[model samples]
Target: MKDILVRSLTGVVFIALIIVGLTWNVWSAIAVMGLFVGLGLAEFYRIFQKENEGPERFTGITGGVLLFSGLCLTWLSWADQRIIWIPAVLGALPFVVMITELFRSKNNPIQNVSLSLFSWFYIVLPLFVLILLRGKANFPFEAIFPIGMLLIVWTNDTFAFLSGKFFGKTPLFPRLSPKKTWEGTVGGLLFSLLAGYLISYFSGLDLTFWLIAALIVAPAAIIGDLFESMMKRSLNIKDSGNILPGHGGILDRFDATFFAAPLFLILHFIYF
Candidate 1:
């Protein structure tokens, strides 16, 4: 009972943070997303860190923040074309990481360099895509794209759990995630469509767009969750980090967003 309360409370707070971050203002959006990229990279490096040799955490996190924030600010066009050069600075970071690895004399220089660079691609890029999705042209201050996209994703996650708990039988992917089931996936999909319909009704956005987004987000979310699970299992770790109390880490919480945001952006570009 205590655990359930803690989980519920944490979940509510987590959702509130994301909504506020995305919907409030440009700075808030940058700050909140930066926190995720910074912390998620930290956790990623920390988990894989080795005694003799490991990823360069400082360089990795710093570079990731600059890259994410720069792209975000650039897309928002808050600073005009001058700030466009901000993202350009990240071009040197790969060389910087590689150079730093030379002094460390790690057991595996290749591992350190590769892993450090990989975080930018895996963690930072997806988030920047989300900011791009939110910063779509001429929609005013309202962040309907991100809010609606996340709503459908969250709805899918919620119902999938409930459905699986009650009616799950055939394993969706027992190897990657034992708890998931075909019944749950279908339940989540159906509910996600309902969530999309509600969003369309309330926000007056296109119904076809929301419905298609639900379809893309559900499977993408499932894949994201399973991929992260595979990563953790391979590393022999339980959770990404202990930052979010009952919810585990930022990486664990936003796994769905990592995949869903980028795919939705593709749809956005093609649609618009």
Candidate 2:
């Protein structure tokens, strides 16, 4: 009972922060996402450090923040999109890591470099894609896309958990996540579709587009959750961090967003 209360309270606070940040202004959205990227990267590096010994935490974080900031600046129109070369240069960070590793007498330089770069690709890049989604040209104030993305993801996660607890019998992926069930997955999908429709109606977006977005987001969110579960299973850890109390960590909370946001952006570009 106490755990449930703590989880509910934390969830309310988390949603409120995201709503205020995304709705307030472009800078606020960037600030909120910037914090997520930084902390997520930090968490990933910390996990990697447990096994890899030397993951170049400082340089990796610097490159990630640079990449994230560059993307945000360009997407928000605070900087010219042609300054793409800045991120282009920043993308060469892995090679720099390899070279830097040569100077150090580390036993697993390759492992360290690969893991550090993986943090950028896995955590930071998906977040950068989300920032791009917020700046979509059709959306005034750059609001609806990001907000809708969160709505669908959150709705799906909630329904999935509830349905699984009540009617879960057939495991969806017992190897990766034993608690997930096919029934839960379907419940989540239906709820996400409903939430998508509501968002479309309220935001005045096209119904077809929003429904399609739900279709993409629901499965992507499941994959995202399972992927994180796989990572934790491989690392033999329970939660990613202790930041969110009952919720585990930033990665645990936002895993669905990481995959859904990028896929939604892809679909948005292809369709919109």
Candidate 3:
């Protein structure tokens, strides 16, 4: 009972913060997301460090921050588009990791380098896509699109959990996530579509756009959750970290966002 209460309260607070930050201004959104990127990368690196001393944590974090911040600034027009070259320069980070590993005499240089670069794609890139989504000029209600995306993701997650708890018998993917059921997945999808329609109404976007966004975000979110579950299973741990009291970590909370955001951006461009 107490655990449930804590989880509920934490969820409320988390959603509230996201709403406030996203609606406040572009800078606030960047700051909030930047903080998540930092914390998420730190959590990811910590997991890798447990098995072996991986790449330089400082370099990875710095590179991720620069990439996220640079993208945000350029996307929002706060800075010139040429600033994108900053992230391009930081893209040399993998080589830096390999070179640094050479002096350290670490055994699994391949693994170290791979994990370092992978962290950027797995964690950093998806978060960066949110900036792109926000900054698109044609999208009506810049703030609402990202917020609506989040709401759809949350709707799917919430409904999936509830449905799974009540009527989950057939596993969706037993190998990766034992608790996930086809019933839950379908439930989440339906709820996400409903939520998307509501958001579209509120945001003044065509209902069809939101429906497509829901179609994209719902399954993508499932894949993202399963992918993270696969990672946790491989690492032989439970949660990513203990950052959030009942939610586990930034990764745990935002795993769905990682996959959903990028796809939404692409679809928004192509369809919206």
Residue 175 lDDT (model 1) = 90
RMSD (CA, Å), candidate 1 to true, equals 2.0
Provide the lowest-lDDT 10-residue window in model 2: 133-142
Candidate 1 global lDDT: 0.85
What's the TM-score of every candidate structure?
Answer: 0.94, 0.92, 0.93
TM-score order of candidates, best first?
A: 1, 3, 2
Off by over 4 Å in 3: 76-88, 136-140
Residue range 103-206, candidate 1, lDDT tens digits: 88778889889888888888999887767766744333467888898898899999998999999999999998999999999999999999999999998888
lDDT by candidate, in order shown: 0.85, 0.85, 0.85
Worst 10 residues of 1 by lDDT: 133-142
Candidate 1 vs candidate 3, TM-score winner: 1
Mark the 10 consecutive residues where model 3 has the least summed lDDT: 131-140
Count of steric clashes across candidates, in order: 0, 0, 0
Off by over 4 Å in 2: 76-85, 136-141
Which whole-number lDDT from 0 to 100 does residue 175 have in model 3? Answer: 95
Arrange candidates by lDDT, highest first: which order? 1, 2, 3
lDDT of 2 by residue, 178-223 (tens): 9999999999999999999999888788899999999999999999
* lDDT digits (tens) for residues 1-272 of candidate 3: 99999998999998998777777766777788888999999999888785457766887787778777766666566456667666676667667777877877777778877887888898888877776666645333677878899999999999999999999999999999989999999999999999998997776788999999999999999999999999999989899998888999999999999999989988888985
Candidate 2: clashing pairs of residues: none
